[model samples]
Target: MKKYSLFQFCLGFILILGCVTWGTAFQNREAFRIGEITVSPGEMKSGYLDVPEKGGIGSRIPFTVINGAKQGKTLALVAGIHAFEYPPILSLYKIKKMIDPAELSGTLILVHIANLHAFQKRIIYYNPYDWKNLNRVFPGDPEGSISERIAHVLKKEVIERSDYLIDLHCGDGNEALIPYLYWMVTGNEKLDQTTKKMALAFGIKHIIIDKSRTKDLSQSKYLGNTSVLLSTPAITTESGYLGRTDQKAVLRNVKGIMNVMKLFQMIEGNPQFTEEPVWIDHYEVVRSDHDGLFFPLTEMGYYAAKGEKIGYVTDYFGEVVQEFYAPFSGMILYIVNTPPANKGEPVYEIGRVKEK
Candidate 1:
């Protein structure tokens, strides 16, 4: 009897080991098909560098790309493109880990930190010799400044290599955003429609038209014919000014990314979050007319009526210098708390969306 019992125990153990091995194989199969590997920093691909070498102030750029191709759509997610936006980077990191290679149907490419130099110093705005803002430099030149060179490589490697791009960002050093997405206006109806659909796929509550400038170099405005063919549907999102490793913000971003993956059918699971997104066709920049202490009466993400007193600009003596009001009834998407605002500096963004 004892011998028989021992024989049965050994057989059971063997079966369990076989099952575990098969499960591991299944999980890793997608990574194999998609090619899971690191494209070392400073590695040259085609004509652009994968990432820079790490050096004090100017070191190697560490960026990881995880490709999960299950024979579906390709989506590219980028974080830390701006050094100071920590929440988005953490969000992308968590999402990368959460993505199961076995369940994914399409390819997912993740670029952790696009701007490694500024990221090292935790600086929001990159200060290159000839330029101050890396975000403004689109389709950068290979022979330009340090920031431009990095941007140039990104345009070729990640931007041109995927079917869709989700550039994650956060509020600048001075302001906090109400988790929103900025869609570039290409003046093409088809493109605009495609962009809107993609934004909805992310399950974000608000969508804003980034018309603050004439063009955006990162996605559309800078893409030439060659870049255009490589470019896919893209959306730039601001995850508020939450610090890096902020669990709340990270979870929110992960949820948004998962929704998009589900929409693309990259994952077998159903989407866990949904929202009726508010699409703003236009936004007005309410700038400060005089430098003083600005006290905000209303909050970000709140609905404000036209001519409503959103806040007050005051002098050092605590006397009200000027009261800032909305020009039209819209939602307060973002606002600043820093005092002593110079004249013509943007104070708030009022958004007006088409009523559903």
Candidate 2:
């Protein structure tokens, strides 16, 4: 009887030890490390992602990492690809503050400002030093220009490290746009489906499934596209317009991102999705043919028939130099709001609505 009791006690102790070891391993699996910061499970760490600098000046991109208590997927939320697009960036700031690491699963990485120079100097599209649009250059060259180098660093440090990605943008200082999300239809069926699901869950009323734009892979250099190419499920969203960050726009973005977190199981809730989003299959940009002031006859989200006159441009003399017409019947996705215009500058983007 004494021998049997000792055996039972030893068996119980071994089982308890095994269970503790397994729990520790599971928690450790959720720990994340980026740059010099190592965030363990149930912890949140904020720091800067250092980028190589030239001309005696260095730059850093601010990042917040939320490593959850449970092991799951890793998501990277990026904003401020354009300096003046404030809604998305503001949403990220709120997300960083509101999320609780202890209540999360997996990890959430937030990049508040991807274009540091542009954001700091109030530049519109491109980096001041390189004059290169950060969005146009992705999976960038390490030895290339400042923008390219920044892109390269992001590709390596952020995109490659993430299991999923969400790049946020708003209309530039000169643009007016409706809230929408871009879903890339990569050849990878699984990734494409995952991205589409995420886009639908983003709480946006408009979702553009990009099949035509990426027909030529060389033209697909946006951060979201690049991330998709790397086999990571990714989506890009646009809200806000005309360079302003309204409370409604910011709240929409915040709610959308939170919905995404829920979709990823990083947060514990059902994702709130739009009932039926307008899915666009193809899109075309209407460019200005003459340098002048642009006047849009239709508002954003308005549908235009093919060959319909959408806008016109007037030269400095107040004479209409060019009248813009829609090439296809579609919803207006984007339009330039700034008075000044130049030849070949985008005046409007028409998204061809897809039939269910």
Candidate 3:
């Protein structure tokens, strides 16, 4: 072989060095960013993602990032989509305190409160500024109402950045609900399987085999639904109810999150999967036909027969306006336990159990 000159040899070495640098860039442990905060490996940071004021109403989302030392999947835990849901909200704060980045494998983004406006005002279901349900608008409009703007920011900053997501919720102040999770199907077998695995790993016994959510991207509506349509595996979990922040409710939320982190391999320990899962094959959220007071005749987790009177709504003057009944035999997933029931609002939900 002919020997190369010093200049040619130097040029060859420089090219090889450049190629090596470029190849390693893809494997670099880059910092995680949200809003103005940046977190490097083995660090945890918390801050607010400012939502610009529009239409005289604006809100801020409180988030935390626990970035791990080792490379792994990023899992997002979101709570307080409905302000009155106490258990899920309380759980996030506890999680933020417990998880140490030095011991973690990947990042954990905790959206402590997605709707601070509603949360501060103690409002349930709807935002105080726009009266729009924050959960009803996903992939939201930047120039729309305050709730919409909040949703838009979350879609861009939180959901889009996460590899897996968990939308934690509980019964609103008015709603008495049982612990359960939605296993939303996107019709993509692999993706559906991934979501199903997440639900099982969440440790909730009641799992809704729900394929009823919208496939239309424009109206993906729910937070978890938006993530699913965007190709991110997500599950919506419901635990506590009636706005009570009991210790049992709080710990249940905490346990579920911990188990899911294990499932993603972002933390140590095996995921404690549900030993026996109750599959809800079909379900319906029976809506009220009149603005009135609702009296539930059945509690959550109990079975009701077809055409059984599950609840009744009475007018403002205490006159019976409408009586609600079970469409078919199933378990009562949730019901409006409080008196105020609006026309076209959900009164109670029933889930038909699937045969094993």
Q: Pick the candidate with the highest lDDT.
A: 3
List model 1 lDDT by residue over 61-116, tens digit each: 45545444345676778776677888887887687667665456767777777676
Q: How many clashing residue pairs are found in candidate 2?
A: 0
Ranking by TM-score: 3, 2, 1
lDDT of 3 at 295: 91
TM-score of each: 0.72, 0.92, 0.92
lDDT of 2 by residue, 271-320 (tens): 87778888898998788889889998888888999999988999998999
lDDT tens digits, residue span 122-202, model 3: 999999888999999997999888988999999999999999999999889998999988999889999998898899988
- Estimate every model's Cα lDDT from 0 to 1: 0.66, 0.87, 0.91
Error of 3 at 238 (Å): 0.1
